[model samples]
Target chain A: MDRFRLPAGVRDILPDECARFDAVQARLRERFVAAGFRFVRPAGLEYFDTFAGADSPVAPSAMFKMTDRDGNLIVLRPDMTLACARIAASKLGAESAKLCYFSDVYDFSAAGNSDREIAQAGVEVFGEAGAEADAAVIGFAVDCLEAAGLSAFIVDIGHVGFYKGILEESGLSPAAAEEVRACINAKDAVGTELALRKNGASQRAQRALLALPSLFGDAQVLSEAEKLTDSPAALASLLHLKQVYALLSKAGKEKRVSFDLGTVKSLAYYSGAVFTGLAEGVGAPVLSGGRYDGLCARFGKDLPAAGFAIGMQRVLRALERDKEVRQ
Target chain B: MIRVALAKGRLASSCADLFIRCGIRADILKEETRKLVLETSDGAFKFFFVKPSDVPTYVEYGIADIGVVGKDTLLEAGADLYELLDLGFERCKLCVAGFAGVRPDPARPLRVATKYVHTARRLYASRGEDAEIIKLNGSIELAPLTGLSDVIFDIVQSGGTLRANGLSVLEEVFDISARLIANKVSLKTKAAQILPLLAKMRGELAAKDEV
Candidate 1:
């Protein structure tokens, strides 16, 4: 039995899991199609560079690599959005287009003992620039979770520029700014204050950094955030969030959303709004996506884009947890 | 209604004392108990004793709503639970130690020994130093004495153990203290219960400090 060990992090998805997971994936795909997103499946293996293209690859090391007959080093797709983005740019051209995918992304950060290959479903809306475009995708994300019968979750919405607004004015080195972001993510206000002081940030900037984490709860938090910083980019980001909030509110999906000006996207290419969906029980996000207005340009097409991917296993875990609690 | 995972040794005893101060009955634990689960008289909470290292896993996986464990174990475990509050007990430091008056040979890849292999490796890696880490169970001091490794990384309290072993501190990595952590889900859903318990314990700690 020990000789038959699976490779590190690989697992067999048994029939029961396949049935449950497939049902959820199919429903989400149906939702995407009804929303006018044409479903697309980029090849399972791409040149490693293609997966690493535009956005830094999500799980580069975990990607199963192979040499093709032509001797090109190919990588199993590590993220669906990166593969989808390439399609939108190369095939769809500069046209404003919507795309969706149901795929598996290979990564080594699951359960610690084995790498997890995730079944991810997502949509990328390219060539949309305004806050309305941002709201549409975010609203779509909320609806998918709703269609899955998830009520105990939140779509934490944020703009990368809100963080950028402070970093640009604080005059901290990139290293120091990164430290501040880490502290903010940890919600360690004391740590953020000390880092700001060490970095010689202005008192106003320090004040904003300290208040950033708390800017998470309600639509009213945006107005509260304005009192902390007067930076133009920061203010514009807040207004963009406010307008997006108004749209969700009009759709009566506002309660499912919250804003965090201090949100940090570890992914580098996020150009505008960034959002994560966390359910009531899971500590990690089940859905994460953001606007990468700068991403398509790397593939030779300059276009605004926003997209998100839901971790299918995590969503199922949440659904399972919900089922147990209800029972 | 609530379940708490408590580290089953020194941290557990001190935490029981703290919970008592906060007026939560925990005497059932002090009575030479092997009982893994004990319920409070009113049955408002259930307490379960687990190994210190497993505390975070139990909490993070939602088997327990909350846990109390050392920052050292928490850091090494790297579990993704919300560190709700610092209980501020079991104070110590995760320090890098070596023989007194000895300089590490930078030319050779660093060789170290520790039970905390992850923490030790990360400590070296963060400094951009290449090091081989020998994992040991007890008496990490024997590693340096036996010449199995150049140095050892472990928790140091009051500098007593290091001095007794003729070891000197090279760098104090970070402070370690007991922290109260909560499952991500439990924190949101069971807040009405967990918050009051946290506030009471926090109040007890603050008042104790004032004395």
Candidate 2:
């Protein structure tokens, strides 16, 4: 057997790549610090139950599991946001804190265009709420990508409340809603229609749900979506997003931001506006985060929070593509 | 420029025609040339002709901003991308085929042979059935003919080949057709270029539907 070979989806960084990686990390560290975000290093390993029990945002199969010395189950930290939230709530001893981390998180089931060992530079703001906080986090995401030397990128934003509101009136079961969410996330109108019809969704709900896939673009999408539903929650989410967009526009960050009401990620913990950083030369989001107001509450504190994590390798890939395109 | 990966041959030609209808300078696709890559005179688009299965890999890696491939290939590769539209051409059916009236015994795990290993496995697993999927690159019908497997899972545009080989479709699975896909990141980053093309394609498809 070849002992030198690394596992699939994992990579060993050599000197050249390591140098680039370190430079990106250093730049992000400076940015986080200057922004009043305190650094925290959560344990690399934690009890599996911390992320696997009822109402858990993460799936157990997505975690790399192992047994501790005491015969209890443990996992190789599959997510950074959950760990930071745990610390901020259970250990930080503060009602509000802006925490940052440069951490490597592991995902066992990551395949097909995603890495297993992900180097993530992330920031989580605890005890913050409202459109201002959402805009600041998204604008910072844009700034963070710029700091990492990306010439072009956009923070595509959305809100979970919009989807939640539509689903609330759909009369579909929770399982059916999750199925439709996956379909919508993939932008598979075919599958979405199949799932919605199979679940006997109302005609109005079907039209609204079907339109979700196309409900992405500039701020005009906010108005287009406004006409789709009268659900108070969905409308309120749109108003909040409008307020956030206005703030961003006033700050001249409008060019770097766009709205995608269809950006409903599978991360069930997200409570408010969520956004993903998309750039040229990368097929996936280079950065992802959102508001998870109830996450800290799960960790024994009820602090409204929002933040984002940059996929270090994807950012580097985009940089490499930039150089290649230039030459 | 919007980069597109086309599955060489019929799919590529059909996509070229669609692009022409949408006002893209894809006339070069009709010429007889040995080149693998083709760029239009206006330089608004570049086309890469590749193996049918490699189309998704290119789009998923962002090497190509968008791609046109069969849903069957998409199911097998299972690459992460946005399924933007159904081109409505190259229609076919993924089916489970073998000798007529022959059913697998419930006691043993049925052995199936096909190039679509992943799709086959998923089909059976979802139904709570045990299936031993045998991967064969070509001539999947030979597996059932030679008794190497009980059935073959493959795309069937017509029943001529199966009928001549004394085989019949046992069950129809997924409806296979050519689909337009876009990279998740490219859809947003290049929306100015890609979205307009998508709208035009939709218009073209709508016009065709009316006809």
Candidate 3:
């Protein structure tokens, strides 16, 4: 008889790995509780519409879906943010809420670092739209990471609104905006400039779009961003980042904060302040979150929201690599 | 210090030449030796000479800060790394070929064999052709000759090997060249050092019409 094979992208956690994972999760729960983020364990399966938020990047076709007995389509939670939004809107309506979730998100995307089923510990701040909220979650992320025995990490912060401002002022169609965003996300400056020109974007918009891929580095790059555009929204986006950075400094975590003006988040729902946490040795980001004020509106309630999820496997991988070096 | 994984053989030599031109002490890289790794006399950089295909793997895993490998290997492996620059050496073209004058049956799914499974699969998909890709480690050209596949998707240089194998080029897919790729983290934390090197290389490459 042949040994049973697990499905592709599936891994049976061995005893030692499971123990280590449990310990990490315990520590995460402790820190999250201390930070006043009430825990909410959302269902493992959600409606297909939940994961597909406004302008969501989680393509429905790439999701694992099945029809329930009533013929309503169900899907594994490809993301927890939408589920959090649903809960905040339905049960905890019209009130400020700070919710945290520890769940496994199923990502059926094409082959990459994305695990088919990912173990994630995430936090979502509801009813707060200020830059301080962005700073608080980021500081919490750093706190959890530090408590986990990881060091030499920086949180890369970006703003979708910065580019969105340019597109809005340019009056490009939604399709054209997507094309421009995709090209910029790929860091293909030439392609983006050509596309913008072909879409009849103004010279200012074209120049700013071209400058985006290189709009990365320390806080000083914020000043350099002034050259991108003079639109009030673009300027306001810069000020928003400045405010977040100032709050980060107030929290004394400014050294671990960097601005990536060109970085594009995978989800289109990020209304402001997108960020990813990158460690020194890890090639892929270990933590990713952003402010998505529009997601809750999909659940028929309008509330400002921002949250981020930490990849448990990535953290473990980095730790294991650290162990190998020490040994 | 910056560490570079230079793909062994011809690409390594070309990359070493470029590095030396950029004021980097990379002569230890071009010397005839069986050593797997070497460091420049200046001690500012370390060079690891790995198999041509393993360069990207090392860079992607952060074992080395940067790598010099052909675009074909980068595409096939699809390692997560920053493709920083194109060194413009070891020029070749990825082409599809089979026994001369043989017409591929359009009614059936084409049996394509090559070491570059991802590249070939993408090419077939782009052409809207269903293909059964057969992965081979060595002697990929024999698949078509031995009736194993209807076509072979392989890199062609000067058409010498295809002519010797009694095969003719069917379609030219695209060009391939060496690229300078960096570990994502290395690009961020070591930008102070790596960016200067990249800028210098770009400047030199622009100045020189020839390697």
lDDT of each: 0.81, 0.92, 0.83
| DockQ (model 2, Cα) | 0.80
What are the per-residue Cα lDDT tens digits for candidate 1 across B41-148? 988779989888899888877778888888888878877666656677789998889887787787888789998988877778888888999998899988988889
- Docking model 3 quality class: acceptable
Regions more than 4 Å wrong, model 3: A1-8, A12-23, A52-54, A110-114, A167-183, A186-206, A230-232, A320-327, B41-43, B96-114, B127-153, B160-172, B209-211
Which pairs in model 2 have colliding backbones?
none
Model 1 B-chain TM? 0.95
Ranking by TM-score: 2, 1, 3
Residue ranges of candidate 1 with Cα displaced over 4 Å: A1-5, A53-59, A109-115, A188-200, A213-215, B1-3, B16-32, B38-46, B104-107, B184-211
Over A11-30, each residue of candidate 2 has an lDDT whose tens digit, in order, gives 88999999999999999999
Q: Which of the predicted structures, 1 or 2, would earn the higher DockQ when compared with the native?
A: 2
Candidate closest to the true structure, highest lDDT? 2
Give the candidate order by descending DockQ.
2, 3, 1
What's the TM for model 1? 0.88
The alpha-carbon RMSD over the true interface for every model, in angstroms, is 3.5, 0.9, 2.6
Top-TM-score structure, candidate number: 2
